[model samples]
Target: MKEIWNLAISPQVLPLTLLLVPVALYWLLNLLGTLDLDFLDVDIDADGPDGGDSSGGHWFHGALRFVNATDVPLMFVLTVLVILLWACTMIGNVWFDASQSGLTGGLIMGVSLVASVVMTRYVVAPLKPFFRMLRADDEKHPPVVGRTGLVRTAWVDERTGQVEIEMQGAPLLLNAKVATGTLSLPKNTEVIVIAHDADTGIYIVRSISDSIPPQSL
Candidate 1:
């Protein structure tokens, strides 16, 4: 046990230890509810082109094509490769010469550092916009049966139309339709959301009484 502890703290294992500290800290902070790292984005393909090509060359193009075909994130692939390389170094250290093991470990550490930086900068940063968009959509579309809105556009008998409804401190553009057997509501007509149609993913609406104001009526 002492030997293992000493080895864990040794210079040879320093890089791995450093890399693990942040992961451990993130988990600890999450458990305490003091910090949430779930939203912290990390990407492994940051150095690639805007379109995700590694370089404007055949080799990069081919590599990206293969990565895309596998339907896996580039960071995940890089992570597995780093793990395998490190494992090889460990095994080589145990079964082969000491000098060879140290060299292999150093090489693996260098590669892992570079990959980590590139991914953090490129892949993770670019995904923030997409995450924000998803969050916005979720907030805009809540499952409420009794809400009110005005038809923002005309609805045809067989077509979808948009409505503007306010909910949760914001106005959302949503798909809406007139109640079954009712006539199409014109734009700017006040409507009550009667029910949500799951099949068509729209809300059924009816003309509200003229006495009610659009906002609070």
Candidate 2:
């Protein structure tokens, strides 16, 4: 335990260790109901350029996109990335017996950052899907095709996801999924119910962008 503690705070891995504290705090607060984290699970939007300084505004968008953060929340992506980087650095430091203030440590840090991003981009792919499910009480699902809905989870892919459909009363939450070939849809994406599977009880959906006429799901 002491050796592990010492390595965690060592200079080579200190930055990632520090970054993890806030992430841990966020999860704790979320579980305690002290924070509304749903809003934080939002995707990056580059609908149009922010005019003041086009490059300045666009740079942030590009960076996130480069990291493939279009389908997941920025915080979610960062949290996973920080953990991966921390792991990579710790392993590298132990393997190399790297000194905190030297070039070897810097190299390990650099490699960890790149490796973490690449690994994280792939790691999040599974979480990006839309899922199909039926309500526990109901045996036969109702027809909701052509209805409009908004993505409610972090992302919607071919396998699993959630969408909320507004009605006269409270909104309805549906088990949403995309067709096998369809790309994953990010949170808050307006979608149109495209199809449904009776056997599976999963609703298939597509983004409103695919059927754009006045822009709505």
Q: Give the top-scoring candidate (TM-score).
A: 2
lDDT score, residue 47, model 1? 28
Q: What are the C-alpha RMSDs, in order, of all predicted structures?
A: 14.6, 7.8
Q: Per-residue alpha-carbon lDDT of model 2 for 1-217, expressed as tens digits?
A: 8988899988777788998999999989988999887632243333334222244435665566566555456677788899999999889888886455568888889998999989998887665442112132332435578989898765667866668877665677776789899898877889999997765556899998888777476
Candidate 1 residue lDDT tens string, 33-54: 9875433122212123433323
Model 2 pairs whose backbones collide = 129-157, 130-157, 130-159, 130-160, 130-161, 131-159, 131-160, 131-161
Evaluate model 1: give its lDDT. Answer: 0.52
Clashes of 1: 5
- lDDT (0 to 1) per candidate: 0.52, 0.72
Off by over 4 Å in 1: 39-92, 97-101, 107-217
lDDT of 1 at 59: 49
